[model samples]
Target: MVEIVPYENCYLSGIVDMILSIQRDEFQIDITLDDQPDLLDIPAFYQKGSGNFWMALKGSEVIGTVSLLDIGGGKAALRKMFVKQSFRGAQRGVAGCLLKTLLTWSASIGISDVYLGTTTAFLAAHRFYEKNGFLEILETELPPSFPKMSVDTKFYRQMIKPSYVLPKRADLEGKK
Candidate 1:
């Protein structure tokens, strides 16, 4: 069984490890030690009225993570979303659960929109976001940390209103 919960101190190392693994295996990105953000940084951002973070777990294993970063005003950016490759298929539902939980939390805190930036290489991810009602938007300037390597990057945004509703059965059905 999978569980979505607030990040705990013990889960930090696992989260970082999984992120590093995904970067190495899937994205071919290398993150240096200084570039690594501490787990406390996540909650600290939220505590400072910046953003929120959560983790996904199966039993005692941390498999995925998502962050809702307050870009300013009432806007929040959905960033650093990832789930381990080994946990795909039905296990992928954990990601959706985490996203829904984050959206609910954002709504409670008055954030009315969420934005995301991803690379075109991740076609599956783009489709997943679309299935979840996120709209494709034009790409903005790449983040300073991102290598100027790709010109096919994409950006997406989703409005988060009190009335915003996810397709209940469709999301469960995993149809893109």
Candidate 2:
């Protein structure tokens, strides 16, 4: 059975491998792990303030990953969503599960809007986001704090109802 859980240090290697495989091998994106500094220090970059990362694992292997970075003002930027081809599509449900997990967490933690940037090559991703209520948006509409990747040519946004108070930075410190 596939299980979705918060990221842990022990799973870093597997998560990186899965992401690299999906990007380089499957999608043929000519990017390296070194280009993504956040992958090197997920705990510091994500998992702080309103940011978070998660993994979808089957047994000891990571099959998918996703992350949300808090850009302040009740807004977040979605990042690093990749799923192994074997676990993709409606039949497998990996991508949908990971997205739902992120959105649910965002709503519970007082996040009002979630934005994402993607490359033009991700046609399936565009359809996926649209089907899940994310509307196509212009880059200019993104928050100032939104991190725009060099390869990103498309943007999307989704509004949600936040249910709980957001945790303070101090509350998350030293708890990784």
Candidate 3:
């Protein structure tokens, strides 16, 4: 792994290509970049307030992504979390690295609740989120500002306490 870092314009093309590949090719999810406008302008959509976007890179080739969108009132929506098929697993730890990075940033920014929505097709993802303390919840429980996608059928929320101590990004940032 090269490193996990904050999103930069230099990574824009790689990010979109990798995510769309995973969604459409690997997972067979019919989503388009037009349907996801955030990918086109990540800084404007995700890099404001307490929100931010990140990419896991392999020598500048984007292999994974995760974003935190600050909805409001100490709440944020976890979005655009996708990992390439070849780079996923407990051993590879690409997904873990991305989630850890996002959580650490969310806690630092005083985000108390992080919500996310996904389809039932991602069974592994459900287990991963549950393993990381994200409890399953109904869509009605989500806050008004969460950017709910049309394909998202299942929802979850992870609560972060102000004084919570999550491992620092360095734990996985540059490690190989």
Lowest summed lDDT across 10 adjacent residues in model 1 is found at: 142-151
Better of 1 and 3 by lDDT: 3
Tens digits of per-residue lDDT for model 2, 1-176:
99999999999999888888877887788989988999999999999988899999999889999999999999999999999888889889999999999999999888999999999888999999999999999999999999998889999999987676678888889577
**39-71, model 1: which lDDT tens digit per residue?**
446677543474778888999898888888776
TM-score of 1: 0.78
Going through the candidates in order, what is the number of backbone clashes in each? 0, 0, 0
lDDT score for residue 60 of model 3? 72
Better of 1 and 2 by TM-score: 2
For lDDT, candidate 1 versus 2, the one ahead is 2
lDDT of each: 0.73, 0.92, 0.92
Candidates ranked, most accurate by lDDT first:
3, 2, 1
Q: What's the lDDT for residue 90 in model 2?
A: 82
Which regions in candidate 1 have their CA more than 4 angstroms from the true location? 38-40, 140-152, 163-176
lDDT of 3 by residue, 110-133 (tens): 999999999999999999999999
How would you order the candidates by TM-score, starting with the best?
3, 2, 1
